[model samples]
Target: MERYVDGFVIPVLNEQLDAYREMASEAGKLWIKHGALEYFEGVGDDMEPDMDGMPMVTFPQLADTESDETVVFSFIVFESRDHRDEVNAKVMEDPTMDSDNYEEEMPFDPERMAYGGFRSIVSYE
Candidate 1:
């Protein structure tokens, strides 16, 4: 069966990477508790790759990151689009998400974060 996934790309200050990881770890737990199939948060260790002269925009370029910042790529998977919606709804309603420091604690600028939902077109495993 095909799956649904919510993906995100964010530019985080190098010094705030730890804080971002902490927040994302907690969020991942909440997502899993709310029925998400999988959660992953990866920091960009390699923002650019050699493409044999092919033109392509790198993660840093897409995120418009600076020398003091790096990119974070994350994704949460669900059984299907409907399942994703259900899980996200539950996650939003989760009391743990209502922290008073919600906005202040976020390590990256929300306006610069890119988010999207995708339907899997192929699965090999």
Candidate 2:
């Protein structure tokens, strides 16, 4: 049973773009180095039509119009849920976690940052 960490990020201000990207990239690398089997990052773009006749998936739209225009998303996959938890605990304890350069510029409200751990229910490849 593989485990995954999903992070949904929205950059509400242009000023936070550079910092957010840097943080996401570095975090991906750190996860891989610390024990994650796979790491990936994705950015939202203009939606295109899909076969379903609906617009392609887009970032979650906030109710507040004042929200920023970009979203940064990333994930880390592990061989098993227990392994994932172990690695995550170590990652948190590692001194480098606190040294992340983008910490000061976290764009979203911490209470509102969307994130979770999930077990793989199915996979095609």
Candidate 3:
């Protein structure tokens, strides 16, 4: 099966770092339970634009991040695109995935988040 991943970059207020971690941990567990092969989230330690003369698109810039905000990069892996669709359907149906409650509970602003789905082109054991 072709592997797929849904990646997200969220700008979180520095003071809410711990809250964001807790929220993400809960979401990750829920996603794994719904059939995600893997769920990973990481805080930014180095988020500078490339110096190699590239297009200069950094995570901070993509997230429209501010000085008081930090970047969070996350991904949920799936066995395949179809599997992703299936898992997401079940996840959304889960009671804990409620959007009304999510807004109040989430630690970051949804407007400043970046998200995308990708099919892995390469993999190594």
Candidate 4:
């Protein structure tokens, strides 16, 4: 079965958008080069959550009322979980991954970044 990697990123503020985008772009490229089947990024909108508690907008959603922070939802697809692990191992060891120079301006708290691997339950597309 196919596997996937999902990442939820929360940006610190609008000023951090460019740096975050650059980081995501470089990471996506590295993943693809290391064997990812697909890579994507979604920008958030200003819409609010619906009555069902689901947001009617994109990522970078407000994390708090007093904060300008927003989240970025991104993911990568792989042929299998094993492939995902293998590619990830290589990606981690690659020097390019460490070259993301925006360390000081990282949008979200690294410890809080949500990420995980999952088996494909179903895919329509």
Question: Who wins the lDDT comparison?
Answer: 1
Query: On a 0 to 1 TM-score scale, where does candidate 2 land against the true structure?
Result: 0.73
Model 3, residue 78: distance off in Å is 0.2
Give the C-alpha lDDT of model 2.
Answer: 0.65
Q: What is the C-alpha RMSD of each candidate to the true structure, in Å?
A: 1.3, 3.4, 2.2, 3.6
| TM-score-best of 1 and 4 | 1
Better of 2 and 3 by lDDT: 3
Spell out the clash pairs found in candidate 1. Answer: none
TM per candidate comes to 0.95, 0.73, 0.87, 0.75
Over 4 Å off in model 2, which ranges?
1-12, 47-58, 62-67, 99-103
- Any runs in candidate 4 off by more than 4 Å, and if so which? 46-66, 99-105
lDDT of each: 0.93, 0.65, 0.89, 0.69
Model 3, 70-117: lDDT tens digits are: 999999999999999999999999999777666555688887788899
* RMSD of model 3 against the true structure: 2.2
Q: Write the per-residue lDDT of candidate 2 for residues 23-77, one digit (tens) a residue.
A: 7787788888889888887765642325577544445554122444555566778
Native-to-model Cα distance after best TM-score fit, residue 82 in candidate 4, in Å: 0.7
Model 4's lDDT to the true fold?
0.69
Once fitted onto the true fold, the runs of candidate 1 whose alpha carbons sit more than 4 angstroms away are 101-104
